[model samples]
Target: MTSAPLAGCILAGGLARRMGGGDKTLLPLSGAPMLARVISRLQPQVGAVVLNANGDAGRFSRFGLPVVADPIEGFAGPLAGVLAGLRWARAHHGEAEGVISVAGDTPFYPADLAARLMEARGPDAGRIVLAKSDGHMHPVFGYWPVSVADSLERFLREGTTRKVLAFVNLHPNTAADFTPEAGAPDPFFNINTPEDLEAAEARARIEA
Candidate 1:
């Protein structure tokens, strides 16, 4: 099946407590900002791409993409970032049916990520499609229907649970399994600490 038209959003609103409480996405991974590498792969997969981040937007001006903050305050997590993306897509590109969200710190996500998610969703536009690997689910990386924006906003305001899995369980969902090439780093490798960044740099050099 062909992929659906999806607007991409890089979720970069995390506190990054494990990485010394700053924007982990801005950290250099192999001589480039992590967000830049993410956009390089994600741009072709979707109609448009936006950065879902909090605080000063000027820091990301170099990327030349729309910067959107979560609609809810106090950094509500990936779900809020997804909502922001959904809203932005609806406002800026009405033709997009949904948003494919990926972690900004995860630069090695597959180039076919959106295509696989859309393929998994098939004809059901309302179904939430996420990525899975090695028997683990990555809820932050998913295709969420723009129609669920209202429901998600309500879910955030009405409940204390900020977990993406808990919110996704409220609706029909599918997981697209991905396996990396032999000897290649895991496609979902994310940089949350100095060690992860170092490992990613080594992998980047090897993969380069």
Candidate 2:
């Protein structure tokens, strides 16, 4: 089934407590900021891409993409970031059918990530598509229908669990499986600590 064009968002709204309370996406991996690597992979895959982050937006001015903060106060987790992207896309890119979300700290996600999710969703405008790898579900890496923006807003306002999977399961959804290559780590592997950064460099040497 033909898929509609999508708007993309890198979810960087986390407080990054695991990495010592700073913008983890701005940290360097292989001599480049981690967010730059994510942007390089996602930019070509969607119609428009934005950074969903909190705090001073000026820090991300060099990226030159629109920076959207969580609509709800406090660090509301990935679901809030997804909602921000959905609302932004609905407002700015009316031609887009949905929003594709990715973790900002994950640099090596598949280049065809958005394409696969859109295909899994088929022509169904309301279906959510999530990516899975090695029996683990990556809820944040998903395709969300823009039409459900209202539903999500209510979900957040109600202040139940802020878990992404809980909300995604409430809607019709499909998972696209991604198998890891031999000797390579899962593409969704993200950096959340100094050791993870070291590990990413090690993998980059083999994969890059």
Candidate 3:
């Protein structure tokens, strides 16, 4: 943890075009809603948690987290969710230094995500921190400084590129590497399509 607390952002705002649309995160994994699994994993790692979704906030009301929508229109992607998280953190979690964003569709992200990223933050770093596994950077799972909220909004409004990496590159950032335990499913495994949901169900059964 830094000098201030950290908040969590569950980015459930995706259009899920591949999963045939709708909220893929709300789909059940095993017996519980997949979003529930994500909240359970992320809640323990932060001072507060909020859900980032586009519509029908009531659908997620059972989870008992504040729902924040992308501040920018046109569903500007995950970066917009990050901005929402940052703004929400600033307003509600004034004591929090930043927000740790994770995909709502990803059920098994590392438990130590917040710690690893905070640990990797050197003295010169008020920078954004991202998660990396198997040499692939998970941009959606990142540590974002609340102070960057304005800058992120500007980046989105510029319309140059809404890509997460494009904005990340504009600031000083680094990635924290995560290695799955032997014989365990990749920690970042997420449910996107029916096939991915099937795999998650199987993984959930084995873990159960």
Q: Per-residue lDDT for 1-208 in model 1, tens only? A: 1356779899999888999998888898888888889999989898899999998999899999999999998878899999999999999999889998999989989988888888889899999999998889988898999989998999999998989988889999889988666765689988888999999898889889
Tens-digit lDDT string for candidate 2 (1-208): 2246789999998778989988989998888898999999998899899899988999999999999999988878899999999999989999989999999999999999988998788878899999999889999899999988998989988957988888888999999988786765789999888899999988877777
- Candidate 2 ranges with C-alpha deviation above 4 Å: 1-3
Candidate 2 least-lDDT 10 residues: 1-10
Model 1 stretches with alpha carbons more than 4 Å out: 1-3, 181-184
Alpha-carbon RMSD to native, per candidate: 1.6, 1.6, 1.6
Per-candidate local distance difference test? 0.89, 0.89, 0.87
TM-score: model 3 vs. ground truth:
0.95
What tens-digit string does per-residue lDDT give for candidate 3 at 28-98?
A: 88788998889988888899999999877898889999998889988789999999999999999898888
lDDT: the better of candidates 1 and 2: 2
Ranking by TM-score: 2, 1, 3
Candidate 1's C-alpha lDDT? Answer: 0.89
Judging by lDDT against the true structure, name the best candidate.
2
Query: lDDT score, residue 92, model 3?
Result: 92
> What's the TM-score of each model vs. the native?
0.95, 0.96, 0.95
